[model samples]
Target: MKSSTLSTLLVAKAIFEKTKSLVNSGDKYSCTAGIILLQDFVELVVLAVLDELDAGDQKSLESKSFDELLGELKKLKVPVVKSGTIKALNKQRVISKHYGQLSEPASIINYFSTAIVFTDALLEHVIGSKLQEIFLTDILKDSPSKDFLKEAIDVAGNGGYLQALALLRKAFFLSYEREYCIYSFRQQESSNGFFGLLGMLGGGRKAYPWTRNKAWIEANVKAPADYIQVDHEKLKTDCMEWGVSTVDVENFRRLTPKVVETEKGVWHLDYDTNFAANELSLENFNYCLDVVLDFLLKKQAFDDGHKWPKRVKSGPTPMIYIDKPIFERPSTTSAIVEYVKEDYYYTVDRVVSGFDVNEEFLYAHLYPKDKEFSLTLEDHIWGYLLAE
Candidate 1:
């Protein structure tokens, strides 16, 4: 491990311990601040790991945002924190700093735990005894193509879809060589000097030594797979069969302009304009990239005899609202309900038979109490307020 990597891990651990201490002290403000610092430290650790791996130059690192850095790490096959966990922590950090709000003790604790888990995993990947075991099994089997795939991922993340596609094409070929046990051969060129003199003396167009070895050797002589012919429709079907959406595949295809074969037999994008000037949507690129990467990772996990985590439930779960209040309502027609969660506030207007004016004792008598609820009704008034 590099010195920078070791120092980053130490700093992250120190901040994580400090955060735990703050949480133990029951100081919400200080705990929230500490968690924010911990998140920054975790990001630094990621950068340091990339530096240790020599994944990219400083100019490239400087151009990428934090999210892109995470993407690069994922491409390099580094086992770090999940993207969702990082996004949630970032959201909490933003709310704390910009809104001047401190998260509840429980949320703060969850954030700290997430940070610690990520830091541990990153350290294991960076400096553990079994460093080679950290990479996915597929990458290990076909190690030569790993660098090409990483480059493709980084290029795709940077919005160079054409160049990334080219890299992917090369990676596919390299991986195919491993899968099909193919070998290369060099063609002999015609000679005009001594070889020509030998040919004239032998009264033949060319002369060759029978003892010379062939250009290529294959232990298992067999026909290789036809890699040149790519069936886009079949690829799309395969992606769908692997649980990827046709919509996302189609979106990716749209961004990939058709390549044309010139008279000289060279393939190139049809457009003549500059690649940087071409309008590309980062959101679309990210969505497609996630879909592709997810499919590949899941396949790799399966090949390695590992169980992939269950797919996260999509959409949103319906919020359950209890019909009864903790205290009896004073009004029989309408009421004003106020809910507070941490520093954020929400109001619910309901037409009911009664309401409670108690500001300190109101609570929703939910059948099942959920501590994770973002908002809880704190007070209710007998009638609707004019300001509302």
Candidate 2:
């Protein structure tokens, strides 16, 4: 088809998708808006068909009313199977938009299904394809998540919705798993008690038992550096923490077949006969699909560096996992420098480079103004350094 015609069809498909979502909302205003958009979607589909037939015809058809456009399609020998339903949708839209009337919530689902049937019939007649041919997954950013969703779409088309849900669950699981590689410096303090005795026994100060223990902790325990990884098993908790609705997630989980993880952490669908016997309808599949898509879209924005509003903490700033390092300097009254007791200092610039979070996260969660401190360093650069 012509590029212009193709673009119009895509837009019409998008409008239909939006209509589906809005009608499902069951709100008075949203249902009314859905009616209006659905009518526009039908008109646009008719316009696209005319454009594909002839550009001049499309220009002429654009000036005609939606009813006239549908009638013109009949004159041109194009399919008009659902013209009655399309006209009814237009009437509802007119009452809602011009008369300020709201569609009955009970009728919204019927209207939604009618639009679906009409669009499918129209698209099939004109382009030898159904409305489902338009893949919303195409609009997602190119990533493994998109690839998985595409696979899910293909399997869903073949009526393997259980398998499709498994793929979608995996996609969501991988998308929101946050892992950060953190590096830290250990606090060097004077040896005391048992450790102090060991220090004196180990060549009295030459071996430096405190430093030796520190090295041991850094080497054997791997304390100086580690990874902070969120648990994938806590899917619902993680979703809530990421700002997704618990209700939506619970609904999706209820509709989709159970996804279980093996001891090896490999995930797969459990095809128990009981679950397999449960009737999974297209509407159920669509609900789960929409939930996953909504989550991924929001996650994509966050991955693109969009900041979410900071949430308030209930109490004092929590201590981070990083170890504190002791800073020793010369004392005015003592012959030897004294070790300054403090938490490990963390510069925002330095920590941001190592952590997956941003400066906003540090300022809000880890190092709020009340918890922040400043200290002079050998480099003479002034920057707020935080501690755990």
Candidate 3:
């Protein structure tokens, strides 16, 4: 290899090493330092590429702000490398930098926690591959690393001070192996708690978290942080503002499934795993649940004076068991939760079979060839976490 080639690789190696060093410190200073370092490096390399293309006389790409430079690149008549992700990263930088007038401490940690992941991808760009292609689907779900997720959930947004109690509750149940690395979004005190930004997957070239709701709206001069403070009410208002409804039976049924009984017994009927896969994020779940609840509630399903009936039709209730264990921090015991939705609208915390409540049903009777563990369902969620 040429000496120049070796020199480039060494530069990349140094940058990569420095990035990890930034992550080693747990505070926000490290995060800010990491982002600044990576941002500067990306700028220099892209500018060098532009200079090599003999565009020097036309315009110095470095002179323009990040946004103008990116827009110019898109308009380039020549064969320029089209990259949405890189542009997205630059856009994120603008938001994080200009809007970060809030705090020194919180900004540092949030950026550091997020920039490390971006740095990894930037290094990949320093070579020539997109990072996502190399990883598995499951890897995408539980991303950035589990340790990161644990530390980040405690992350304060620009407005973290307002609602520290919400995150402190420790009462919420979350899918640890979720499809989002949500720390990329605006880290702030949220009304919906940790799950508020859950399924917001894409920001085009950048991960959705990095690109977030704007800090300000043009029309009314509302405080940017107010969006997080009243997300639930705002969301409801936004939906009503849109003023649209779905009249299709197929779409409605897809949202609200009928309970079916086969030889294997009862489960969510006509279940579309794909639908649940994406909607597992908090936003989507609440949206779907609301649509179903709206339809049923209008007919007085939950009301005591309903003409059709006060309760649901007779059906066999299933049990939820834990033949396997899924881990949670602080408490290593695996948790298995199973709850049944009864006849159209009525649902309960557990399966009620002829005046009896059963909680063991979601697990398999035998472990797979690669696995082995036995746990009772009662011992997991309520037993372990709730146990005094």
Best by TM-score: 2
TM-score of each: 0.32, 0.53, 0.23
- Weakest 10 consecutive residues of candidate 1 by summed lDDT: 177-186
Q: Over the full model, what C-alpha lDDT does candidate 2 score relative to the true structure?
A: 0.58
Give lDDT per model, in order: 0.49, 0.58, 0.34
The list of candidate 2 runs beyond 4 A from truth reads 1-18, 25-30, 48-59, 72-81, 121-133, 177-250, 258-265, 270-279, 301-388
Clashing pairs for model 2 are: 187-325, 324-344
- Quote the positional error of residue 137 for candidate 1 in Å: 27
TM-score of 2: 0.53
Candidates sorted by TM-score, best first: 2, 1, 3
Best by lDDT, which number?
Answer: 2
Per-residue lDDT for 1-388 in model 3, tens only? 2243334433543463465346445556565555555555455444433443444442555478765654554455422242444555555556556775222444444544443344334434443322222121112234233222223224422323212212211111021101211222344333132334332431111223223333322332243221122223433443344332333112333443223211222222233466545433433322333232232222222233436734566544433333323222223334433222121121123221211122222211222223223232222232211111
What is the Å distance of residue 126 in model 2 from its true position? 5.1
Candidates by lDDT, descending order? 2, 1, 3
Clash count per candidate: 5, 2, 15
lDDT of 2 by residue, 65-142 (tens): 888887777777877776776788788889999999989866877877777677677777777655544434334687
lDDT of 3: 0.34
Pairwise TM-score winner, candidates 2 and 3 = 2
